[model samples]
Target: MITETRVKIDWDSLGFDVVKTKSMFKATCPIDGKWSEGSLVPYGTIQLSPAAGVLNYGQGVFEGTKAFRTVKGDVILFRPDRNAQRMAFSTKRLCIPEMDTEFFLDAVLKTVQDNIDYVPPYGKGSLYIRPIVWGTAPALGVRPVSEYTFMIFVSPVGPYFKGGVKPLNLKVSTQFHRAAAKGIGNAKAIGNYSASLFPLMKAKSEGFDEVIYLDAIDGKRVEELGSANLFIYKEGVIRTPALSGSILEGVTRNSVCRIASDILNIPVEETDVDITDVLKAEEVFCTGTAVVVTPVGKITYQGETTTINGNQMGSVTEKIRQTILAIQRGEMNDPFGWIFPVNQIFKR
Candidate 1:
């Protein structure tokens, strides 16, 4: 096993970028065989044939979750089971071999434990875990490949957005649709993100932090951000875009809704969020595994920019963010049983 002392990292200056760790977990599934027993491998580049299905046909799916070094000097994962379930969903959707949830969770635990020392000290940052599966067999036809590889890697990262926790300025993109109504937008497929890169980069060039995409069918209802789910608050009620087979069901988004309803006693609704509603919203925010619960300060659509709650993080948004963070850091009681302690899992 590789030890962590071989690498030197400045944890204090960590950003939302990859800081290579000691090892990663890898497992392979043949075309007609089950997944192999995985093991830890050194973090490095992977080789793939030019005619690989994942390269030529875009057959791949990935998941993102974090491991936190809690205040009590123990490492934990927030709702890893949910991530495991999601990965299985994504794999099935992409025509890849379905991974057992237990196998997925076990792989994640082993990978994180091998790189445990890279998990920053409490309050510094988190170990970002990325689990990815791709078709590795070379193929010329537009079909599923003969082999698949599942790998999990970790990186120490800070906030997703620079200047940590500050409200974001977003642009409403009517010209670009994130995912089609019946497409793979619901899955965490690699293609879904590639489609957003152009729009996202354009939004950044326009002095916006991110882009908010609308539904592809009618283009009237708000779908989600480039990489996060959208939320808006009005009249003491919290609402997000409904999961209408076009939106990715985010783990953080679900957690936010649950926390708002159960802990904060705020009403949460998943329905069609129109552009008009977003304009009139008193509060706007986005959630994801990486972005977490971040406030939207301003929203611009069709030449008009609406400032949300005087361009600051709303009280409700702040409350929800704090509550989730507290629970994640083990500073508050986890009424939802979302926290998964790594040490406890290892003991078993």
Candidate 2:
């Protein structure tokens, strides 16, 4: 079994990589149509059939979110309910049984509590929660499985970028599309990422931090970064691509829109953003659960490059990042009732 004693490590040097914690939560369901009450188990691998549905057909979905250790020595989760809702949406599309919000939140909270000792210090990092559901039954045809597994694991991770909080150089991919216009792009399916691997690798090899995919149909409208949602600011307005059924609606992206409009009093718009608008924007950034908000220094498209905010982080971007981080870490008030204290769920 995984231990409660914290392992020794350089927390300051942590990256957005997996470092297994004490325990994980798991449950199973069979064709009989009943889900077992999940339990906390030691962190380890599980045996699967050679023809497991997930292995063969990629019938799986997952979520990424973080739990922070507050300055007051409390652990808190940020908008887990939204993650639960998104997971349900994904599973429904994949034809897998969806877990209710109560069960999903309970599993996440229990896993965090079981691995409490591994929760990084407030400033060092936060505990990253990954909840995945997969079809487990052996299958030979392209169909849903009769058996399924749901599990959640926790890890402590630092910033996604190696250098931390710096503007990233992005490359636009016209030769490839991350998702079709009427496909499962909006779902958190494992297959969606698998399709992006080659383009992302090519972008990295070309010295770009990430790749921004254009729409599959016209290949002119902006979609999103490989792992995050895109946003551009110009003339006191913040605009991001609308939910065109091809972009993953990011939790951080939603939070930024709300914070910008409600707190910062800045106008926010969701519409079809042309690539030219991105090239001329005063500032550009991407948001995700992992990379909360990262500025874009430069974007290259069709052998032409454009610099945003003189290749520096914009003031509005900085303010939005700070405000969200502050609310997450409990340094500022969360008027939206987004923060859920772990202590309230599980006694210390």
At residue 218, give the lDDT of candidate 2: 92
Candidate 2 steric clashes:
0
| Residue-level lDDT for 307 in candidate 2 | 85
Model 2 per-residue lDDT tens digits across residues 1-348: 222345876777889888977799899877456555989999998999989899999999999989998878799999998999999899888888876777898889889988987788877889999999999999999989899999999889999988999899999998899998889999999999999999999999999999999999998999999899999999999999999998998999999999999999999999999999999999999999999989999999998989889899999999999999999989999989889898675332
Per-residue lDDT of model 1, residues 19-119, tens digit only: 87889999999867666598999999999999999999899999999999888989999998998898888999998988788889999999999998898
Predicted structure 1, TM vs. truth:
0.97
lDDT of 1: 0.91
Q: Pick the candidate with the highest lDDT.
A: 1
lDDT of 2: 0.91
User: Could you estimate the TM-score for every candidate?
Assistant: 0.97, 0.96
Per-residue lDDT value at 51 in model 1? 95
